[model samples]
Target chain A: MMNLSRRDTLRLGGVAIAALTIAPARARAETEALIKEFAGGKTPKNAGLTLDIPLAAENANAVPVTIRLDDRFSGARSCEEFLLVAERNPIPEACRFKFSPAMGMADVTTRIRLAESQTVVALARMSDGEILVRRVSVTVTVGGCNG
Target chain B: MLNRRTFIAAGAATVAAAPAIAAPVAVTSTTMLKPKGKKPRIVIAGGGWGGLSAARHLHAQGADAEVVVLERNPIFWSLPMSNKWLIDVLNTDYLLHDMIGPSRKYGYELVQTEVTGIERDKKIVRTSQGQIDYDFLIVAGGIRNGYDAWFGNDEKAIEFTRRAYPSGYTADAEHVAIKNKIHNFKGGTMVMTLPPPPHRCPPSPYERACVMAWYFKKNKIPAKIVILDPKPRIMPIGGGFKAAFDELYPDIIQHIPNAKVKEVDPFNKKIVTTAAEVKFDDAILMPPHQAADMVWRADLIGKTADGKPTTWAEIHPTMLHAKEDPNVYLVGDVMGAVSKQFGYYPKSAHVANYIGKIVAIYIAQRLKGQEVKTLLPDNLCYMMVSGEPKEAISVQFDYEIMPDGTISQKQIDIDIRSADLVEEDHKWAQRMYGDFLA
Candidate 1:
């Protein structure tokens, strides 16, 4: 096990306590509703969804993120809708990406605004009725929003 | 009463009689080729600090010159304020502004085009769009990373992709990778390699390490940022950077001087240096850089001893191209003059703006069939050491032309760590950017 110094322990404890205190029941329900709306009531398997984000973002204003899906976009079956949500942002829905089969890949790269250090979820719905979900926890030292 | 024609006839007669004594006059006439119309056609390539400064200066002089600036990048990135972005003090947006909008304000044409080559004989610049002719061409495209052959094969090495970040130095994609790599780092060495001299922002790598170490300490990340520099001393602002590094983040950073990265063992995260084989959890390698692709493609660039295109362009004391063509001039990082290489030497937008004014004067004199005058450029570089806003330093200098037509510097150091310096830096940035961008 890695040894945690006094400062490290305090920082970790502060982050953990903040997470516990901020994970309100309302936010959880809103996130659940968003996921459902994103997937049309279908729960997606998280295995095929790959989320690429920094473990820690120096500035919260613009964090580069890439969402890659392993699902194949064949004839009539494509990644139609994708949504990005952060647990801490006032506006939970950061952005939405819409794509079609003719666009080739189910990969998108962009810089999103993060409010705080929290888990970000990217949910995608395919034309074949398959839902994909990916989550990455980014520790934002300074909030990018409201600055 | 002597009219303008009589003065011209007398000048021509004097030039024809005493060629050696009137050499300066003849050279002046060549520079002062008047435009057919009221406004002279000036085409500038590269919208970096130098090119923007030239465009702004031409506009400020109120010269009858139709200035057209061709920059590959759509936006202008501020090098001075970029350090704040690395430390999370400033957003990327704070360091970037629209180059096109500023060009319009300055009454210059901003064309987004990739310069292919320059036909010096034909006095034409060949771009991807089409060939553009100019009475005078100012090249200020800035530098590009040459990572080919540094890490085994180019394909094997992680290709550097530049994304549109507010700060031009640190791209969005690169910052994401660096942040992720640094955060996940646990009790291992981290290396930040500095490229050889004549690169942009000399003290930047050291400043980067300072900020990174600050974050490491704040987050309690058990990692040390070891800086590998080829130069014997910390660059441009050597004393100030050394003082800050020692006084602030000494425990978090290990300095390795006179060392160059020989090879990289990517699988093991080990870099073979001239001194020793050091291993690291993450590495931020800044390879050697050269003039932009367009500059290297042109024959106007100065060559190194090994025949590679050195970022430096050899020029007359007046800052015009020494040979190949007299109408073309180089400024900023690519000027090939020794003083321009120093980061603290007026490489900032403020200084570039002044240099542009000098270039405009030279061009205007040449257009009027008059003698072109030698320019003495002012150097000013402002640096931000930390986010506390008190740890900034600004260096100012005035160039003195030497007997051999080279420029020697007269240096003035101002510590901006005080409250007054901070305000000065901000004011200077505002004033310079307004003038240049306008």
Candidate 2:
């Protein structure tokens, strides 16, 4: 029987916080370098940002991802921009989102295509000039024998 | 003790396809592997690819539980790498491993016994030796070749088909028989049939035809193999295999697609299918697949919450628990309900082995009173498509759960056969076998 319980799926959103605090594997260096370029020599720390994505995804072409900024950021001094990266994809920078202090809670939810199994990152430069980062590993697999 | 040589010889000598007739083990003698402490006792049924992986990981992760693996066979014979063995490319020794190596290495208990039944309410597993109580259980008994699908309660027909024409999925005897049949084949038409998808090793029948055709061409034997496939094209993976057949052994292989079998005359060596009727001098009729009998016996074969019966146990899509019994889990080739609803992970050794680890981690987390997070299991499969240059085709599968709870799939593959891929495949097998055994 199918467990298409929308409630269960909804509960899965915030539960991955602990497991998603990945240290970033070696393969993510390119994406990290790109983020570094975007930061212009500023260091990014894991703060006030949560990168939510399924740890294992069946559909590599379009995996749902969410990026939310925590209460640490006040509306008067919020991040002006956010960058999303899929490390293994040929084009690591999936997209960018522009924001302003008018938006109290800055959250970005979108779908991404992963090239293979690798890390996914969300980067933002807050109004205080601090680089906020959230990263998680999304295992992407393709090409297995059919069942 | 049965070594690889002895197991291979036993398989070769007795080609009657002896399925899981477990050598009865006495309970008194199995005490060495018995549970000693009050910790959660996790009894795993069928120490095949998945069971062994779960057992190994449970010990490796230091799960706070007593891991007891119940297997029917003392030695392991891997089915994945046996295609070459069938055509005498690789030695039979390559396919065998000792189950004791991993058990000892991981410090888990390995008990060789046949599981009779499961007492779900009591949390007990009845075996030929005795009943063992468990706090958590893993059902990894592999697949059942349903000859009934074709013969339909015709005991005489089913028995005859099994004896004369058998699939190489189970016992050593079946593999031996198929090997001998191919090796001693006289010049004529040879037939190989494929059941519907979600069966054992998706690209196997195609690969089998390829290897057999390769052998016939290598030896200059005047024979051809006709592939009676049920699927429209065996597409995706089959595309590469079909190309290999045309380019390499064009004269030796003839593939017939959309061949859904209607009737088979096993006694007369003829099969009638939706596509074309074929009579042959030699044939390998693989039975339609279902979960092992134990799955159905336990009432674990599930009907989804919305109410549709699945061929195998229905479990929590990610957590791998039986819908009816959270204490029980499903691993290996038996996650049919999930496979049916979502896209299926190929019912291969790699998936079984990978899923085993996931199941172990989930159970171990629960035992430790930690919030268990569900992880995905990936499959990396390589198939030997050519013999002379030792080339193979590889495929990998990854999954994501859709909003509707359907497990969506993404597949990346190289159907093109190459020598480097073969080497990599060997390395992968060696590493996996090492992880599983030692």
- The model with the greatest lDDT is 2
List-wise, what DockQ does each model earn? 0.01, 0.09
Residues B1-438 of candidate 1: C-alpha lDDT, one tens digit per residue: 458656665665421222322244532212322223456678888887778878877776676878878776667667666555666766777667878677767788776667777777777777655566787888876666666636545554544322211112422245555555555667667887777755666326676777777777777888888888776555455556777778777888888877777886555667777766788777777776666676666676776679975565666645455456677887666666443312223334544566666777777767667776665656556666665645676555544554454444444445324455556667666766666764
Query: What digit string (tens of lDDT, one per residue) describes model 2 on residues B1-438?
Result: 568656764663232111222233454422233333588789898889889999988987789887788888868988988888889888978988887767878878787777778879877777766667888999999888888778889999988888898877774578889999988987899888887766878327777888898899888899988988886565445557878989998888888889988999998999999999999998888877888877887778877578865677777877788987889988888876454434456788877887888888888888889998757766677788889988888766656555555565656656667898888778777878876776
Off by over 4 Å in 1: A1-147, B1-39, B158-187, B304-308, B338-350, B412-419
lDDT of candidate 2 over A1-147, digit per residue (tens): 112132112123122111122234644677767898878789898888999887876446556688888864564578778899887676678899988677776887776777677878899888878888988988754323443
Cα TM-score per model: 0.62, 0.70
- What fraction of the correct interface contacts does each predicted structure contain? 0.00, 0.21
